[model samples]
Target: MDVVVARIGKAHGLRGEVTVEVRTDAPQERFVVGRSFTTDPAQAGPLRLRSVRDHNGITLLGFEEATDRTAAEALRGTLLVADVEEDEDDENAWYEKDLVGLRVLTVAGEEVGEVAGVDSRPAQDLLVVRLASGREALVPFVEALVPEVDVEGGRVVIDPPAGLLELDEG
Candidate 1:
């Protein structure tokens, strides 16, 4: 199946290298040299990975299809896709697409909301929950705040601190 590995960010320099908003957990494996990825818009790629580098903690990638700054800049915001076999046995992993739309509840089984999206940051991922009142909550995806993720059960049990859930509330 096709899975999003990363999204093209801004052009880094005069070269074709572009900063990427990595989506997959294993970027070193996914964005290796000579790896080709199918682009979401279709016209921007099949971009072949010509070079990969790290600049001040950001991942910069050069594609064979884009050889200059303008070419790389044109690919900004395009999603890079790769084919991968699903590992159903991996219980510890959860993709953004899999977590989105799942029911979110407190550990005591109180309805909280549904997962709207996932914000993948450098330190930890944040689960964007759509609350009943229509506001969104950024639940830190951690063992303490989010104890259980029952994908099969279509729910995630969160154990938030006193005011964590009310962060986005009025």
Candidate 2:
């Protein structure tokens, strides 16, 4: 499947170079010359990496056709994606894509809801679960509250503290 790798930022220089906010866990080497990826599906066509270099902590990329500052500026905010094969991860880790739409169950095996979405924040990530009562609950994605996640089984076992569900009712 195609996964988002980065987002094109402002033009870096007069040449066709642009700053990119790296989003993928893969290293910079993976985005080197000859690598093929796509920018915004609506506007940009396909982009083949002519070269990729790091400046400070941000990434600078040069695409085949983007030969000037004006061309690079047009690509600002475009999401860059690369086609990748499916792979397994370590036991405790789970992909955000896999968590969406899975059922959520309490520690005692009581069905609470389905996962509506996942939100990443500076303090902590949260699981937006759509409860059976048709209410939304923003549960903290922490080890204390979320004990287990079974992607293949399509369920997440949670251990919500007292009054957690009640807070969602208000």
Candidate 3:
């Protein structure tokens, strides 16, 4: 359930602060003083957050052990992750991590596929569904097309417009 929260960028200053490009939607909640996270290289650390600040629209972080500029500089390009969390108000909403294995179906209960991945893009996010034919279907993750998401039922109901499924079905 470890989800990528941010990627460490260049060293910010001699104060052991490093710039971090946030990956999570809730950056403020993920990166804060005393917060802790494990890294990718496995050797970098299960870093503990020392400080967080903003500069020129960039997020900067200071970890407990990265006490010097040289120490922080060595952590460039590191990824930060946190445990998955759920909220009671999360009805009809889902995180990409939680959607990866859900079943996909037409509104009428016809099976379409299983969710293999989710592509987050600038224009729109897409659900990468593995169809029954062993091929992939890229469905736009818009509310108009995907009207229902039943996480408990482990299925998503998609109401695609005409000719939409045809594009990937062939």
RMSD of 2: 4.1
For candidate 2, the per-residue lDDT at 141 reads 91
In order, what lDDT does every prediction score?
0.90, 0.82, 0.84
Q: What's the alpha carbon RMSD for model 3?
A: 4.2
Query: Candidate 1, which segments miss by more than 4 Å at Cα?
Result: none
State which candidate, 1 or 3, has the greater TM-score: 1
Give one digit per residue, the lDDT tens place, for model 3 in 1-170: 68877779898779899988776667778887998899987799899999998888778899998999999999998988788666668675567777888999999899999999877544677888888888888889989989988878899899888877778453
Where's the lowest-lDDT run of ten residues in candidate 1? 161-170
What TM-score would you give candidate 1 relative to the actual structure?
0.95
Residue-pair clashes per candidate, as listed?
Answer: 0, 0, 0
Best by lDDT: 1
**Candidate 1, 23-42: lDDT as tens digits:** 88889778889988999999
Query: Which ranges in model 2 have alpha carbons more than 4 Å from their true place?
Result: 89-94, 104-147, 157-170
Candidate 3 at 23: error in angstroms?
4.3
Off-target runs (Cα >4 Å) in candidate 3 are 7-23, 40-44, 49-79, 122-124, 166-170
